[model samples]
Target: MRCLLPLLLLLVAASVAKAADFAARFDDLVRTATPRQLYALLYDLPKGGDLHNHAGGSDRPEWMFEILTDPARNGGDAFYTRARFGPETEPAARYRLIRRRTYEQLAPAARAGYVPLADLSPAERIAWANAFRLDAPGEGRDEFFNVIWPRRGDLSQNLDARLELLVVNLQAFAAEGLAYLETQFGLDGLVTPDGRALTPAEAAPLIERRLAQPDVVATGVVVRFQDTVIRFRPDAEARLSEIYAFVAAHRDRWVGINMAGIESDPRGRPLRFLSTLRRLRAQHPTLSLSFHAGEMDGADSHVRDTLLLGASRLGHAVNLIKDPDTLLLLQQQQRVLVEINLISNRLLGYVPDLTQHPFPEYLRTGVPVCLNTDDRGMWDSNLTDEYFTAVTTYRLSWPEVVQLGRNSLARAFVQPEVKAKLLAAYETRIAAFEQKYGAGSPTISDALGKVEKVKPVTYGYAKRTWGLEFR
Candidate 1:
């Protein structure tokens, strides 16, 4: 018994040592590296698609501020101001879409101290726009998603504006190395102008008119289901039917539907969403079906119930982690993809940070997880930024990032052939990138000044799934 206790102690100590080694390595990489070096390790990497999106925040915040303040455009927001919270910590301040400054300084101004999810203040908004301090961890996720709830419905509708907004956002994402996106659009179904519902045909004109723009279409737009908020209306089902039928007709533009919003709508049921999806799938089996599942720590019943709702993609899906059997069923089924947003989760207070996140367990167990930025504007993030948070914080290597990228492409709403083609292109990029710039993660160690691994050499990344040796 005494010998066994020493053996156990040694094992535990060794485990702790390994963890400390990884953390020290991470700190070295972050601290000693320049943004440019960090960007290279980050730049031109072909991310598959952004499965999770909030139309308002998915793009750059300056774009939103630009629209709000542009003399050429029109929205109802008023003048900006600030309340004195602290010298360095003014929770309120005026922000403007000033064109003269560097592109990073733009932000929107407003009346009162509206502390929305991202801290609705000029200073905070400006900081977020610049990607300054954007990588820090910890906050409330339920509030993160729901806090912006008041604005999403109002901000999403302007097709022309959003189309323009998305083009700029796409260019920015591309600059950071993303090539594809399963970008969600059109949540206007919840509110209709003049109280007249958007008939399927009307929705087509609403969308096609925007997609007609070359810049808009160049971004690779995929419409998530379009619906107005129906939590209060009598015609929730009818409206959904309209949206589904519209997708059936224009399957190419409208890719899928996600039942976003707080769970537990008396109407937010699998039968309703499934009935709509099942009907839509009959015509467009190719159409994707994703949902914001028990982002809530909802009732156990809600988690399982949402899974059965026939969703192809599950965004957030934090609570579902609580039900292991259901998690297994999802893994076995394989069609379901999770939009795991580490920053979003921490910001929304799901877990303290990536260290506490369930991603390692979920990914190791075979449940397909796709990293995403749920609300870029609010979270003050981009898809690649979210990817970075996943890596160093979670201790994922170059190989896993490759797997994550492939997982995203596979789980994307695009056709199978498109995914194949995209992966092929990535192979070409990796080959060229490898010859010029080294392929490994740069980690400094106690024994060595700087060590970098050539990813292709070490982790056999392929056009599809990661190399078997890794598993």
Candidate 2:
């Protein structure tokens, strides 16, 4: 008993010392100055490869909205529908979903004629701008996208319009600090406002002919044209064949294919989609699938369903947390990258708020998770804002931010050599900045004091699978 007393004392001392170190590290982080120093640490960070992005206008809202309305594209249909919650939750008198001019819909909902898309009251042209008028609004996912539908009528079947919008946004993205984007743009079966069915094959030609101009492919900016599938389409098999063929024929231009909107999609479509996908793979062999699997609100059944479908990459497979087995699959395979969209979940009422978002938990355990803006313009968010939220809300430090960016780069869809090329350049710059500034600043500041020098950590973080630790 006497001997054990000393041993226990030793153990307690060690625990307390470790706790002190942890507290110190965090306290220093809170005092960080200039979001840019955090940016310098995280800026140009290898975002383990972006896996969550919409096809058109994934850039900025202003970039998306104004470009679409460009006289060159089309002087088109654009309106705003204020989104809202229930009567019990919202004390604003009534719930609504109104169709008003996008410009007029600008005022805050607290003002008159403001319907939160819950229950809307239409406003006239001048009043529309008075109510809600802005070419580029906040970056919430729903707000960004809700505007799209009202304007869809004015932008359909015009391939150049889509490309121009994307191109314009890409430039905006670069200006805003993003290095790359992996989007599933241009849908085939997706209905236009007038209800026209547009396919990848049709949209591909327009983009392809444009890329034929040389500057498109030479930009080194990666653009992945993801051929899409509607979950449980009655004609799933036939459409699957068409996409497989499209990808095969345009392998040079196309990166892969993905299944979209499969979560609540009816038709027992998941099983059928997987069965057809497996058959398609056997036939074509290289038709890669980045399926939107297990975005389940409350179940793990879809995780297994996605694996059965032979998905190489998993988009929004957020619900994988519900099952331990799927967690192992993600760790072992390390191939399926999840597209994390914190802002989207909040606006869409997926998890109530961003804190419940799964990325930090996914990362702590070593899963291949990447940060993406999802649909920034629609959601009224940007990559920077998402990164900021993660660091503050999730209490992520510089190292973890580095880790997330590293994960994004690792899981990126870019080819091996190309990724290596970018990662090398990215790391070199980081190393120089760190060495020039310091190993790690207790806090980043704009005042330009404190950081004497900064040096980069050599090589990137090793890619590994971390099991679920949060649950």
Q: Please write out the lDDT profile of model 2 over residues 62-118, one tens digit for every residue.
A: 443454444454223332332333455332222222223432535665345343231
Instruction: Give, for candidate 1, the lowest lDDT window spanning 10 residues.
Output: 456-465
How many clashing residue pairs appear in each of the predictions shown? 12, 72
Instruction: Give the distance in Å from residue 257's predicted Cα in candidate 1 to where it truly belongs.
Output: 1.0
lDDT of 1 by residue, 119-235 (tens): 346667655344312233332443344333433333444444565676677766665556566666654532242234444466567666655677655654333332322422466
What Cα-based lDDT does every candidate model obtain? 0.55, 0.55
Lowest summed lDDT across 10 adjacent residues in model 2 is found at 459-468
lDDT of 2: 0.55
What TM-score, computed on C-alpha atoms, does each candidate reach?
0.67, 0.68
Model 2: runs farther than 4 Å from truth? 1-30, 34-48, 57-61, 73-151, 187-205, 209-220, 436-471
